[model samples]
Each structure stands twice: as C-alpha cells, then as structure tokens.
Target: MSEQLPKEHVDILLAAAIAAPSMHNTQPWRFEVEGHVIDVYLDGSRTLPAEDPTGRAMRIAAGAATFNLRCAAENLGYGTWFGLAPYPEEPDLLARVVLEPTGARNDDLLDLAAQIPYRHTDRHPADATPLADDVRVALLQAAYAEGAELTWLGETEVHTLLDLVLDTDLREIHDWHRRTERSHWVGGERTADGIPSSALGPRSTSYPAAVRDMGTRPADRLRDERQFEERPELAILSTYFDDPADQVVAGAALERVLLTATRAGVSASFLNQPLEYDDLRTKVQRLTQRPGNAHMIIRFGRTRTHTGTARRPVADFLPEEQS
Candidate 1:
C-alpha cells in the first residue's frame, strides 16, 4: 500500500471535494481515507427521492467531488488514479481514488484548483454580452479532456430546451413531494450545506425562463423579479451512455467545465429541470442531435459575483473514527 497522506493533506483534499456543486448543494458525498486512497461514497440519506428517484444525481455529485479531490491532489504534486463503481457489492461506493507522489504535476489541473474557491453557481441574470469564441472552445475542450462531449445549443435548440423546462416546471408545480424535498435543501437561512435564499437570485419575470428558478415558496415571491436575458447561452454536457459510471463522468466533466469558465471570468447556472424526468431528459438529448445522454444543461454568460453558498467542515464528511 502507498504511504498514508498526513492528516493535514487529507483535510485539504476533503475541503476541496465538498465544494463541488450538487443538485441543490446537498453535498451528498462522503470520504474515507486509508493510506493514500480516498474512497468516495454517496451519502444515501441525502438522496432526493422525488427529485432523483434513481439516485443518478447523487452519483453525479459524488463524481464531481471525486474530480475535485483529484485536482487538489494534482495541485499538491501528486498523480491521481481513480475507478468508478469498482465494487458490485458496495453500490454506494461511487469511486476509489489513489494519490501518489509524482515529480511532475498536471499544470492544467493545478490551475483549475486555483479557481475552485471562486466557482459558485451564479443564479442571477447575466448580461447580453456574448461569450468569446476562445472561451467557448476552452469550455468544450475541458469537457472533452474528461471523456465527455459538450454541445452548445443553437437558437432553435435553446427554444426547444426552454419549452421543455417550462413543461417540467409546470409538472413540478403540483409535485408536493418534490417541492418539499427542494424546500428542505434549498432556500431559507444559510446552512453549512445547501443553497440559501440569499443566493437564490431574483425571480424571473418572463415565462419559460432560460434559467431554472430555485425559489420554492410564496416567500420567494418577496424577492425582486427581473427579466432574464432574451438569448441566454446554453450548453449540454453528455456522455455516450446512461449508466451509473457515465453519470459520474458527466459530473467530473461538469466541474472541469465550470472551473474553466470561472478561470475565464465567466459565470454559469444550471437549467436542469428537464433532466429530472426520463421523457424530458430524452428530449433534451435529442436537442443536441448528438449520440450521448444529456447529463447537464448549463447557461453561461457574464454576471456580477454573488455570495457563494456555505459548505460543511471537512470533519463532517469523515467517518467517526477518522474524525
């Protein structure tokens, strides 16, 4: 076995991992450090049955956290090796990551680590300023580097996606279970985990909003309503398959893309309502007209910096013995 990482290094790694974005900032991942290996697990209790009945989102969140761990290790001058769904018996074990000392480190990942603390979901309306061509290509390359494909939607495709989002929102309007789940994790006072109302952004005044409104209750109405940009830039991140492992790949690709955007002074938010339903998810995939299952719907543009959501301490994610 490789030499065990010191407690301080493990703490640094876990802090970066939990900063990853989840469906509603659930931070639904746990870590176990044995020697130099970090086992990533889905905290099943954090699963949103109504919002994610199949646990796909939870696995994706785990994958994203794992990606952050890898980046942090690289930044710390170590090479990272990881496998997804490595054991059949341990279904919740989403990934197993091993870090080893390497004389050379991945400069790309190291740069991404610097942006981790700044990468937050920007829920506010973005300006009409268009994304530069180079920035767009870089975001695409980031996803490709992680074995995933990102497709930026055209005007017609964005319209189609907006329609799907509207349909999904209408369907969710009466889903008491889903609403309750969202209420628990999102809005209200700032908690160690989950997004708070302050980060929810202003409600959209237009119908078929380009961004998915995070507001859940009548209290959300008290926030100002603003008109979102008419032509919001959108992209879909996907993998060739829809298996559990592929979902993790999608999440890693997502964090890479998001961090890349943050490095370029661009802001992003998710319009993922359509992806929660199987039928709507299929339609979202069709919008891309590509050969992959859509895992995330991202809206990227320029916006002012907003207060980031809070995260639990590193000890909160460790086992009792480790803590």
Candidate 2:
C-alpha cells in the first residue's frame, strides 16, 4: 500500500483551501486536523454584519473552502467523505472530512487543484466575445456535479438583471443598513474583507449600476474607465431550496464552475446586487426561469486587466473553538 500523506500535506491543503475565493475574499474560515479527519470552522469575525448579517456569506466561504479541500485531497489520491455542520453544539464547526479508500490521483483533479492559486476575481469588463461551445459545456458539467444549474441569461434577461442590479445598488447606497454593512466589511482602509476600491472596476457617477463601487466617496484606488467597454456575459447558479445548506451547496458549485472557467482561460465577476434586495431577487429568479432558488449572478468572458484582491491571513479570521 502507498504511504499516508504527511502532516505538512494537510497544512498545504488547508492553505489552498482558504485560498478559495469567498465573497469579497473574506477568507472566513479555519482548519483543524486530527489524524485523517479535517475539521472546517466558520469564523464569524470576518462576517459582513451589514451585507451578510445572517452569516450566509461565511457559510458560502466555508463551502468554497470545502470545494478546495475536496479537490486537493482527491489530487493526493484520497476520496473525501464529509459531514456538514457536524456538531449540534458547535455551530461554527461547518464541516468534517474523512479520507476514503486510497487510489491514484486523477489528472483532472490535479488540474483543478492547480488552479486554486491563479483564480482571482476579474472585476473589469470582459471582451465582447461569447464563450466557446466546449468551454461552456465543461462549466455546465462542473456546476451539475455540485447539484446546481448554470444557465446563461439571454438578452432580455440580461437587461432585466442589469436593471435590477442598478436599482439594488442605488438602494443599498442610500440605505443605512447597507452603508453600515459595507463599512464594517471594508474596514477603515479597504485593507480586508468586502470588495476593495482597487477591484471596483471603472469609476462612474452614482447611477443604477450593476457593479458595487468600493471606490465611492473619499476614493482610494480605482480601475480605469476603458475597462468597462462592453456588457459582460452573465450566468446564474440556482438550487432547489433557499436554506443555509442549499446556499453552501450553491457556493461550492460556484467555486468549481469559476475554477473550470479559469482553467479554460476565461475571466469572471460576481454581481449579487439583484439578490441583495428580496423583491429584485424574486424578479431575477422568475426572469432567469429558475424553478428553484437563484443564489448569485455571475459574469464571465475574457478580460483586458487583472487586478488582484486582498485576503486576510489565515491567522486573523480563524476561530478558536476547534483549535
């Protein structure tokens, strides 16, 4: 039989796991390894009190980490058996993963695991070209593997989604709760959590806009206007239920699809504006013909600029309950 992976291998995987993109790169999680079992902890310290007061974003972040862990463990030839929200007493303990029977790592697993580092959120506008047929099929397959559906928004749906985004953005900008939430997540200097000014795409006057501008008011760093030249290719991930469990599942699928796109030489951005407002969220679901819960709206295509976002160190946001 092959030798078991060393402790350092687990640590490397944990690092790669946190490297998975969370909403705003929040990195809201920690890890605990005991023998072959790995525990994932949800750290509410990084939770956006205003935007994600219910800790949904944190759950989704943990889901992204879970996806990364699964990919890395599979790359090392271990099938993963994981339990979600394992302990009734410990709400922060999001998941526990146990290694399954040993086998050789598949090449596809390695390819996906290798993409953990290179997949950054490209907020700039994409080139005005549609995705290749083969690439789109691959993305669909990846999304399906995680129990979610990825559907492209047609012209009418896209315009409807764009309008919903703009309306939501405007409302959030004026709403006290949203303003407070943005401030809480962004920190004082755009140093950690939430979208940073550097990744806010092009700067424009307050309008019903699709993208959130972390650069608004006392602006720090902003992207050039030329990057927002064309409308982006938008897609949505939908699940059958609107519960926390389903949200986590949707998030995991979202990461897998994003990684697949990244591997296929595509760039993407997430626009959750429509869903931030309950009414708009419902409108979007109906518009997209989503028979279930529409979790997030994502845009993908080729991009001209690459702007790297910031992430909190693994030490800062990790919870101590499992440590």
Candidate 3:
C-alpha cells in the first residue's frame, strides 16, 4: 500500500487478469484503480442465468482474474493483499486488491504468469493415457498452495461423477431456456467473447461427455459429431467451505492448478453442469467424503487440439478514468 505503482504495471496486470477462463467465456469481471489498489467487481449484465443461476461461477471467474492480478503484480516486484466482498452493501464489488512494491519477488507465482496465456480450456476427448504420477503430485501440490484440495478420482468415483454429468445433459436437453442460454455463448461466430465454433471440439454422439456439448446443439449445423473418450481422467476441486469468499479463493486455486497443468503439458475442461445444481453439488461433496464443498469437476489429458477460447480486450474491462 505504500508504493505508487506505475500505470504500465497496472496495465500488464489487467491484461493477465482478463485471460482467466470463465463459464461459457462470459468474462464477467470489471476493475477500477484508486492509487495502487484495484477493485474487482462482478458484471451483472453478463450473468448466466441458466448456466449459473446463483452467480457462484461468476465470482469464481472473477477470483481467477484476481489471482492472475496477484501473480502478475508479484512478478513485477510487488506484493498484493486482497479481501473478498470488502463492501458487503455493494454486492457486485467482489474483491479488492492492493499492490505494494516488494524488495523480494515471488518467483513461484512469477513462473505461473508465463502460463496464463497458454492455459486454454480443452473440450476434446483427452487421450486415455494416464497422467504421470509425478505430474499428478505436482498438480495436487499446486492446489494445496492455494488453500484448496484436489482429489484425483478412482474408478468408482469417476463412474458416479460421469453419471452426474450425464444427468445434467438430460435436464438441459428438456429445458429450452437453459439450452438457449448455452447456445448464446457457444458454437457461434463470436469474436470478442463466447466460445468459437472451432473451439467447440467434436460432438459426443454416443455416451454423454464429461464436458458439455456446446458444439452439437441442433442450431449449430456446423458442429461435427465424434466420439469422446468413454472414460475421461477427472478430478474434484473443493474448498473448506462454500461462501462468497471461499468461492473466490477456490477460483484462485483452480487457476493455479490450471497453470500447473498447462506447464506440465496437460489440457483441461470443466464438467460444470452437475456442479451448477444444488442437489448435484451436494452429491459431489458426498463423493469427496463431505470434506468440503465441491466447487469444480475438471477433466485432464493430453490433446493436440489447441483451440483456445476468446477473450474481451482489456479496454473493454478497464474502468473509466478517475475525474
């Protein structure tokens, strides 16, 4: 808080922040800077009413951006301090980050900064090859560093999780509103935001994929059908509790894990449909022995498909200049 950060540093931080993945690539975050402090707010206009009714995923997305901000700041010889929901009265204001010059740099987070742009969501079928044991250990450690737990699922848990993911497909298929909301963000010629058709990967015509079928929807005739891996490599990320603050913390951990995976040559996608529902979220918690609230279901493997999602420009996310 004592240091006056340069504008160029803040610009680099915001650039890294917007690169964090969001649900359906909605990129629901905005920022304002006062002195050296940056306030992160949720964009109420970009809500996913159908996919994220409670705005849980929205907060997580913002949290990931906040983490990126912290990482970028540290790499620039600055230390960051933040609090979630600093102004409870203003609920849309999710978190505030203060950047101060630090004589010592955080090399670990600085290393992660390099992976920010390379970590894209991979929706295609991950090859059946198992992750290297050491790599799995590294990923788990990465989550631990962020105050969250990542559990690699066994066969039994994977089967149950797959069932839960498929159940969501059934619910989505019958709900016109839900399908329509999803269609708005996926398999389109969207340039700034939303998943582009090429990033949609192949459609799963047989068994339900752990990943959502953004490409195969009826309106999208351009999406090609293909079989996904019958059994995807999966993991469950959970926080110690479920609340606005914990959700944000989980988002930070999620991004750390993602960057670690990217550095290790692993690609990932989220099976968020099940985690979107209260009932399904509870079940996923139980599958983890009720240790904590399950925030995300992630699938990982090696895929050559580098179809990264779209991101809005930093100018679009930056707050208006102070008067």
Best by lDDT: 1
What pairs collide in candidate 2?
50-181
**Most TM-score-accurate candidate:** 1
TM-score of each: 0.98, 0.88, 0.94
Tell me the alpha-carbon RMSD of every candidate.
Answer: 1.1, 3.0, 2.0
For model 3, residues 1-323, the per-residue Cα lDDT tens digits are 54555778777999899999899899999988888999999999899997788899998999899999998888788888899888879998988998888888788899999988899998787787889999999999988898899988888888898888888778877798877887788776777899888787877777656776666356665467777776777899999888898888889999999999998999999887788889999998888775799898999999885868777778788766631
What lDDT would each prediction earn against the true structure?
Answer: 0.91, 0.73, 0.85
- Point out the higher-scoring one by TM-score: 1 or 3: 1
Model 1 whole-model lDDT (C-alpha atoms): 0.91
Better of 1 and 2 by TM-score: 1
Order candidates by TM-score, high to low.
1, 3, 2
